[model samples]
Target: GTQSLHTNGMDEALALPTEKAVEIALRTQQIIANESGVADTVDPLGGSYYIESLTDAIEQQASEYLAKIDKLGGALHAVEQGFIQREIQDAAYKTQRAIERNEQIVVGVNQYQTDESIKPELLRVDEQVRIDQMAALQNLRAERDNDMVQAILGRIEQAAHIPNAPLMPLFVEAVEAYATLGEICDTLRGVFGEYVPESWV
Candidate 1:
């Protein structure tokens, strides 16, 4: 039985879908659920041998990947060492290669493509909005207690270095004192440094 449904609007890849596109997507889902009669059945492919085999293969592959991560001292260490990043990049490269080679088919993309140029009209943010945001942020900085913000930010930096320190309260305090997100992140970044991934090329 289906518990949920996700129907993407056409041209969702480029930007936020238009209202007409979203309505069309919803209508398509309604048609499939009400008219197709598939929703009347539960566990339609529960006893299928092909589906069972596919499920087993997925489980086995996932277990193997988990074991690999465990060997590398779990997820954090794996990410720090760039194992996860490299795996993602490699997988993406393989998928792109397959699509280019026609081993994988994406309708309207690599096969049975339309000749007409599809130009989507994307909504643009006005320059005045940015100017207003900048002014508001500057006003906030001037109005808020900068001294308190600095003191809390200092505590946050110190807490980050200490093992197992509860920093959430300090974060809340910092935010209440009008500390900016970038300032807090920058302070933490100064302590932990940054992760620079190897060049994919």
Candidate 2:
């Protein structure tokens, strides 16, 4: 199930996959199998000089990247310092710029421009669905034993504060007690403060 989306710089709200796009995508797979005969070969470009060189270069670069991250005190430290986030942002920006400059041709996006409006059937979630969910949660909380729920939540909070604590069992117990996601999160939030991202701009 491949759906083509018109995402303007990772914004998912603008995703509109048309029926024609879906048909084209399906036809592409058929063409690859029938016309291109891609399925007939095992590692079709395996021995090609260009493919081999590109593969080696990619592997070497990845290894170097991992080594640099290890020097910076591993993945957690890199994430905390926003190094990983910045790298991803930079890569996305470069790709977008390349597409805009026509250096990268993304078929329907950068090349083969279409003037016709493609209004696909969009999925819409009903407001009543959320209201019903909230009502169900309220009912569940009201019916469950508050004292037991609080005791389990308190244990969960205590476990979270301890370094390398086995919190999985406690989480399982909390869920079995019919504790809502918000309740579990809120309990943990009290112990561990919510994450606030550092200014990257």
- Per model, how many backbone clashes are there? 0, 0
> Candidate 2's error at 161, in angstroms?
1.4
TM-score of each: 0.79, 0.76
To one decimal, what is the Cα RMSD in angstroms of model 1 from the true structure? 3.2
**Cα lDDT for residue 196, candidate 1:** 78
Q: What ranges in model 2 sit over 4 Å off?
A: 1-51
Candidate 2 backbone collisions, by pair: none
lDDT of 1 by residue, 1-201 (tens): 368889998868877787778889999999988998778788777889999999999999999999999999999999878899899989999999999999999999899999999887764567999999999999999999999999999999999999999999999999999999999999999999986776644
Worst 10 residues of 1 by lDDT: 118-127
TM-score of 1: 0.79
**Mind giving the per-residue lDDT tens digits that candidate 2 earns over 57-118?**
99999999999999999999998989988998899999999999999999889899899897
Error of 2 at 27 (Å): 10
